[model samples]
Target chain A: MRKTKTALLIAASTTMPALLLSACGQTPTQGAASPSSGVVTITWYAGPITGTGVRSTLISKFEKSHPNIRVKLISAPTSTNTDRANLTAEISGGASTPDVFNGDVIWPAQFGHAHLALDLSHHLPKSFFNRFAPGLAAGASYKGQEYGAPLFMDAGFLYYRKDLLAKAHLPVPKTWSQLYQDSRILQQKKLVRYGYVWEGNSYEGLTCDWMEFMTDAGGKIFSNASLTHSVIDSAASLKALTFMRKLITSGVSPSSVTTFEEPQAMAVFDAGNSAFLRNWDYAWSNSNDPKVSKVVGKVGVAPLPTFSQSQYPGYSNIGGWDIYVNPHSQHISQDLTFIRWMTGTQAQTILATKYSEIPTNYAVQKNPAVRRVNPVLNIVSKVRLVPRPSGTPSYPKISQAIYTNINSALTGSISPTAALKKAQTQIDRAVSSNSL
Target chain B: MGTPNPLEPELTNHASRPEKKSPGIRRRLARQGWAFALPALTIIAAITIFPILYSIIVSLNHITFTSQGYHFHWVGLHNYSVIFSNPLYRYSLFFTVIYTVVTVFIELVAGLLIALVLDKLIAGRGLMLAVLLLPWSLITVISAEMWNYIYNGVYGVLNALLIGIGILHTPVVWLGRPLIAIVSMMFADIWKTTPFVAIILLAGLQMIPHELYEAAEIDGANGSARFWRITFPLLRPTIALSVLFRVLQAFGIFDLPFVLTQGGPGHATESLALLGWQVMFQDLNMGRGAAIAASTTLIVLFASLLVLRAFRAQVGEEDLG
Candidate 1:
């Protein structure tokens, strides 16, 4: 019986591979038959960049206009890291099922380097590029090739409680120093527990906020795009970091801000416990909702403050993802059709007005309808977008080192100067090893 | 020689008999075994082994996420060297060890105490056991969130209760301070995991024969003395096993810390697993991430082997006694 069992096991193992191979041959025929019936299926994997119901409603409208095409929607995770992982896995698997992918602007370079995305440079008109904010087009390009079409963009801004400032008898602080003074006064009066709350966690959100301060202080991560060494250890960068540390030490901002990510900090500010918050434009809508926020209709928005008077104007780091076609897609024609339709003038208009997604198309940006729906687009229009350094293949590694050091500085585990120097050395090493 | 000859004749007769067996019967038996084992093996290979092997291979090279596909370079031990030399990685390892040791030690002692309390022939024994098992069955994510709410500085129940009773006049930022954050995380972990250990120890308590305790009592031993003499030695194996499981579980913990503190207040609560995840998923540097993962696997394997060996030694000593 034992001998029979052994023989049976060997025989079973040998035949299983043949069965699996035969099963795999049947899947593609099933997928191919759907697109031939005068019906094209476009699958989009994106995040809820705007309100929840907005993307679905717009897709529904697009389907209504073209009855033959069916649109399938997939939402990416709210976390940036998870979204990137999901997108990369899907692309690498070569499952053309998700015909279109919503990509972070930073990701296009990485994805383009892998040949996972189609070159959209020819599809996009030069006029379309001219209308976007100066650096946005460059943000979506890798090695002078465009792989994605920008859908919407985001930049950091300061949101302060109007009532708290008015009660404190203070005007909007135009510089970090002024903001610090005002915050101290508010805390002294017991009006708020914290002067400022922002993303200080060692994540991508922190990096975005940190870049705004670095730019304001006349420092850049890379002198040129090559990223041979970091410029973050400069005197300007040290000053910016030192000022941030002072905010925590001097009781302007809570020490807990060192652990705060976007949602955590947003929750603190939305609870009316904070006098000011540094976040993206999306917070404006959420903070004004009476159901969710304690300080509804009492919030005001402005540009992030700068430290130096002679530096170039204060800049907010540009965020938000783009939509791109998978290069390895079996249904390339159908995917291209979907991309064109989604970013087309009409779709962009509906998305901007209804969903508050800033349109990448310049023509849609000026539409009277979009302007009326979201007045905050005016802020987005003037916002400057900055790309991350180490844009080659080492972006994630370089960013992690930067955030780790910054986190150490924020937690009082290391001095700002030491943190910057360490970050510079680490980034320099990572770049040398990973750069092509 | 006579028995061997008879057996040989029987075996030869059986072997000749197999020629009459239907090929379909053999095929059917083979098919059944394949059907039984294929799903489990396939799942293990696909989800666990394949990824581990892939990571190992990737770690030896330089790979990066890009638009086309992963770019690779032959960097040989470069990634591993960088990780060892990096101070952040070193700190993460230290923290992971401290977290594992502290949590396992606390949980084992607490769990044993609870099990002893439950082992008595008291009223509502079944109900007590069920209630004691409740926290162990809860989803880790839900538990972490609940703890977060309880520890919230501004409106947390902990602060409100403490201040209301005049134990403290101010709210404490439970997750804000570095040392306090680590302790808070440990508190949350112990709350959720103590029940697991209790359940295991309860089974061990039930298995100890009552006659041994009766014999100890007859020798004029008190309850505590009887427990130390009769119950403690037999329970050592179970206790050791429970500690090993808990230690392994704590070593790879990710969700609790990720949801509760996200290895923050600046890496105070960072573990080896969290650091590996940050490298692999967050940084998208699968090579370095895999190296970290490989090291973690090796450490876990070494620790578990040592624990199992000790457990075996205790069992052997018990047998000799």
Candidate 2:
């Protein structure tokens, strides 16, 4: 009995280490095989698409064209965890199983730096760079090198209720003062709950909207490759912030706007309760969806209003996603091939015309098919893409400083001048500390 | 429970027989303990302890997400200094403390009340206990979403009820104002966590002997007097344990406020955990984020120690031992 017990203990001890080692080593492998012999599985992480069913249609087409290459589509979370967990796991584990990653435009730099993305300049023609809007090319570039191709482009535009404008006897607001006036008239007339709805919550979306106002007011957050100390605190930025404050405080915008994000603001506008909404191109399709939206036919798209006369055209913050190959991917050649095919003119057209994703390719943007699907393409052609301040390493820190101060100002926690002054101090400290 | 006789002949023979074989037996037992613990220990080390140590190392470095790859420079204490100097970080710290104190206090009081009510051996007591524990069993993420709808400005049941009762003419934006947003989040937390505390206390209530209460009644004690003299004293240890667990859980709160407010209505709801998440993911400042996370862990540890000390004081050292 004693001998048997001793043998059992020794055997258990020996097997334990083996079990642990096996558990640690069991990472999922990418299903990569020759196209002829086995199905070439390509995983794609995409954004939430509503109405048009563009993503599903595109997947079916891609699979049909290359019958051997099976496309596995996964939806990325709208929240933060999906981005953090998926990207971190892929980079840390050196796994390239997800052949195509739907990267945020702001993230290319971060991912590229982590050595998790493949440089697409090698696979595609150099002229591919020329096909996007001027500043859009920068969205996919890091340190003067192209890491990925722009999949889609989004520029902020003013979507308004045409019926409300007509009822209030107002034309589209040409300037900040005109916007405020129109909103006031509409509110007084009981045409809507407020004059406008916008994303005012302290987030990346808020920064995008604030940039449009700051740039249109002729105030820049940074200059000469470094944050311009006290420049964003200038008269122009204060003017823009003051106008925004007046609109909110004067009852032209509801208190709920303070908590609204992209979808929340869009939902209000689509419900026909708001006169104006400042959002991306994606809102166009949702607003035009006859089943869900009340003001489908009455929606109008125009450039965001301007404040300074010198700023000829109003600014629109560039927002969109791109596709990049993971550098650590074992199948680099295959990933590049996939990226090339996805961003090609043919695919871009299909994505734009079918899915409502504003194609990055200039040729696709001007394609007659795109115009037929969405008449707003003409306006998208004219709009310029404004790059985020976070294009540099110090951007996140800089953006936080700006948004924190702006949020304080908007919430009446601090005076605009005081907020701007404090913001300048914070920006200077961060930039100098980071050696930007 | 009887102690082994040291002078027994079998024990003496076993001790006197080669000491070398005894060492082997002891070694074998130690090895068995290790073998049983190794799998769990290895997993814990890899998933928890390793990341914590790695984060400390990363926090001391200047890391950026750029095109080339994670280029890092050793910049000791720089990230920590930034967090210390920033006013936003100060604001987040203040809000986290307020949230922790408010939520924990409310949950404790409400939990104690519910536990007292459920302590009576009423009809269908088992069913009532299960129903009381249902909220605790539900996943936090789902509850957060449900509460978000309740707090919604348009077509929310909360606002609808308030209006129906003629409380206000217009719908109040529960999550739109700064101060109100924090209060709203606290209410949600109190609703979800009070049940957990009740369950813990309920188990403690079951263990208390009925003889003690009977003796207290014979001593001419009233219900309130009996509760103070007999019940409260005995329940002190269980209450302390429950509060300690709650304080730790509340300190590290993320999902409730995150889902409901997204730290919004202008940074009013930004807790340490949410701020840490933003730094790590949104800003991609892993170094600074890790530093914040490390600091948070230390702060929570200190707070828990204080609570534990208070708990020991109430229960006395002998009972704890």
Candidate 3:
């Protein structure tokens, strides 16, 4: 009996910690509303969109428009990956709050496949989907079912220093080579400390940057609509990656660009260190803000440059958040109403004019008043847009393969050829669902 | 009552009452002890054991989620095979192992040196220890963000200091190159955790009697000789304990890399924990992710067992001596 007890004690102690090793991925379920209250409260989990008051303002306005439905805002982490992880854990474990969430535009396919999101296409009318700008609705769908409502639209744009270009007596660069030459000339004249900066970090942002460069060089990630195969190891992709590496080696961009995400790249440009920046629509307002920027009036917005002058405006990777509803939400009808109002004219106009977010509503996007509010909005129609290979539910893994390999090449740890080959291998494995 | 109790003699002597030796009384006392501890044990079992078993079960299945709930299809050992064949998983395992080995070894050595210095310190020792623990006191995610700024190539404090002293003409990207980025991450980890190791060693140092040093000095033993012969041998158990803790913590490192690098400059700094998180949450491949998690747990368990065995052997030797 003593021996048995001792053995049991030893086993429990040793294995106790081992058992603690696995994650207890339980999300706190929201308390349900009492039936007698007659007013419904829905939780909206949103990350910081542009500014501090955007969510609150939208919530207050939304509450005024619909008196019966009250919205509770649960601010999410700023890191997109962290936000995605939290939402996934919560919804997968069957927590019933966060009726609506603001998620990355690329998450629809993965979330839809997992059944974490409510199919908006089924609940909403066909005419409701038609109100969004063309391609926005399609981008928010997977397998012909829409899981998200496009809240706003965003695409990459070139933000350059008007002062630096004027000092070098150069016009706006029409092609990638022209931009490179202009950057070199400006750096040689000591007009700017660095020539160019963009998101080269190993994350989803890098995939977006890679998409722009690869598409400009006439390369495609998937050769077919099915996205079952990867064609990353191609000549056009090599040209794109090679040029990206050259920017670092030739001192046109700081070697640190390999570690840069959007914020860091933008900070360098706004601090008067770099001649050009590649970022989203919000960069226009950010660069023009006197408090956070040194180049307030000197920044000029333009469409991203192409590889050749003939394809003058390069492809800008489509990026923006979408509104998704929790499948486990208690108030599905209220969630639908919140999504509809958030995507409607009043909210879209406020987002476009006040926050400088690119509106997904076609009417607000084409509104002359909204166009006059920011220079980024004026050039939105001219830039070519390319979506990341997010059609497959394996998109997150596919993007990881793209960014990690491309970043390795950019950091000079591996050659562009080797990186592309590795990426191709990984992407193939991802699509096949045969490897982790 | 049918079996003899190995610890009965010690229990009876401690109790110092002849009647307490009765099997009924001892068994009742044991029952009461268990009754008092049951609540905490239940909580621990619920939180830890249940999830661990669930996670192991998850590893053996292909899972899908619908509006209704999860759908599990068992595919025994398939998930494990997938992770084994995946190059990313292999790389992450390799990286986590190397990182743990390098960081833990260096921390042990550095911590020993700091503890020794502080042990001999005559003035302001309390103040010094408090200051030493400042880095340890800071939340890891917050400190990682701080390190991010310090390692920033364009405007980093490290770059500015190096350039100001004319060490180089231009800044080096500390987190850009794969090799350097790994080194940078390791340095950040060592900087934050060395104090914890040092404190543990310091407590162990204090527990050594002063008479041992006196006895050694009278025998004409030098500083190095005394350290090896007296201080080191007596401190073997403490050293083993610290190593066990450090090894377990280091092997599962996540927050530092997740915040500072996000396993970047090309997956150079990706730890096993980070990779598991990416596979589980980001990819939503629950089966493969649980397999990664289960495998990580087994590796950690194996490493800690080796540590505990070494500790037990040292204790056995001490008893013989």
Candidate 4:
């Protein structure tokens, strides 16, 4: 009796584990079509466009139009790098719930090379790509295939306190030197605590800010268009970097700007503390919003100022999001439909007018009605746009090299010359795939 | 032997007879135990062992993701060589080690002092313990974010307080300079983890027999003498355990620095885990990332072993006792 009981217990326990293991292997039936209703559900992963339910609004609008499909919203992390990591793990691991995801505009080359994003050119009509503003469609392509559809456009703009500028009897500065002199006057007159605040933190945003200054001084990250060689240690870069450092030493800009990101810089400008803020298009609405801005009506937006040697408006680094389909997604057609609708006139108009996003749709971009709603949209065509050296998949590392070394110089940890030389060496290593 | 008893069969149940059945019973019990543990063991293998083994293999190969799946090209130690030769990786290694050593040392010392004081407290001990656990209980990311506000350069609370009290003539950018940023990050880490170390040491302190201290006191030993002779010697195993735990955790520091500075003002505060994450996810260099992870694991493993070996004699003696 005892022996039989032991045998029975052993059999039951062994089978229990097998049952558990088998149960663990099964995945949930997400993104699956309902057998009875014939309705399909797809997940869309996106970061916060606006805290005011923009995603849910868009989803409801889409679902109303296309009743056959249901869209589930998955809120992604606000940090772009964290979002990329999560998406990379999910797509690379073959999880297919997120049929579509919103990625950074700079991710096309890297995502395309890794096969993380599906080639939309293979699936969508060629005419679909033409709806985006000029240069946006090309920006969303890697090699010969388009991987993402540009959803919105963003560019750097110079935001100044009109009240402060007026108080100091200064016109809107058109050149870097002019802006510097004006800022000094504002600070010296006790009209403003600080002159300028921009993103200088050692992150992706710094790379964007660096590109503007570098290009304004005729400094190119890469000597050749193919991005095979880096000439970041040129004399032009030294001049640009030196001016940035002098801004701190001369007390025109706060020493703490070295730690500033978009929010911090924006906060300083919005609080009526700083005289100038270099930020993206969204700052126009943010600065004008009375709920958050002390200088609501006192702020004015203009194109970023260039160095004396360059033209009036300096380059604005292209910044925005792009929508892409996951290669592992089960609902490819539905994903494409969502992408098309998002970039369509109706949705683009909502984004532009309500949230003040610069629409990537060329029709909406050129619409006088939409441009009037968001003043930054009107100035976008005037400012020169420069693309980050993201033509290659190694752009992330290259950007890191630029931002970290440049940040060191900005912090006075190293000289501008040393920082540029180090950036050059690291960028070379990244291009050659020689370093981590 | 004198008489052949009726209970002779039971009485003669010698080693041979019982031992013969015991082996079969023991084997059956062992099998049953294993059957019951199989599910948990399988989960562990899947989650922990498999990833570790796969990460090591990945480190040895050039890995790329395609639509079909992952494609691996064997590259021997090329990835390791790349990271090892890189200055950034070298700096990260140096920074992580120094960070771990400094923070752990400070935490241990501070923890011991707190633990000693707590052990002697007569009132509100429970409340004190709960309060001390608060920092440790809060998530590292959340606490790090709080630290970010305190250390903000433009309008930080710390600056406001300092200026109000007239300690600082001007506000300092706490995370703007390399040295200051590293120190600030370490301070935040110490603030969060010291309480954990204290709690562990307190448990160890409680475990020591009160009579030992009493006996030492009766023998004319001073308070410091009592601690040095009785308290320190008996707390060796617990100290070893806490140190090992702290070293392992501190070496893999990520969330604090990641939130506080993102390994800036120029990668000055970058930890090994941060570097590995950046290389793997941000840069999409899987092989190099895996190499960094594998190397970190090996270093941690080696460090832990050394820590254990140093206290092996005391630990073994305690185990035997």
* The candidate that achieves the highest DockQ relative to the unseen native structure: 3
Candidate 2 lDDT, tens digit per residue, A132-224?
Answer: 756777778878778777888788999988888887778888677788889888888777887888987666777888889888877888766
The docking category that best describes candidate 4 is acceptable
Each candidate's DockQ: 0.18, 0.21, 0.46, 0.31
Residue A401 lDDT in candidate 4: 95
Candidates 3 and 4, the one with greater DockQ = 3
- Rank ordering of all candidates by lDDT, starting from the highest: 3, 4, 1, 2
Q: Which number leads on TM-score?
A: 3
Task: Give stretches of model 3 more than 4 Å off.
Answer: A1-23, B1-25, B317-321
Error of 4 at A264 (Å): 0.8
lDDT per residue, candidate 4, A1-436, as tens digits? Answer: 3322332233222211112221222233345656367788889999888554888989999999999889999999888898987777667766676899999999999999999999999999999998999999999999989999998889999999888888777899998889899998988898889999999899999999999999989999998878988999999999999999988888777888898989999999999889999999888888888999998899899999989735888889999999999988887888889999999999999999988999999999999999888888889999899999887899999999999999999999999999999999989999896879
Question: What is the RMSD, in Å, between candidate 3 and the native fold over all Cα?
Answer: 4.3
Instruction: Name the runs in model 4 displaced over 4 angstroms.
Output: A1-30, A33-36, B1-35
Residue-level error in angstroms, candidate 4, position A283: 0.7
The most accurate candidate by lDDT is 3
Model 4, C-alpha of B187: deviation from truth (Å): 0.5
Q: What is the C-alpha RMSD of each candidate to the true structure, in Å?
A: 8.0, 7.4, 4.3, 7.9
Estimate how well candidate 1 is docked, as a DockQ score: 0.18
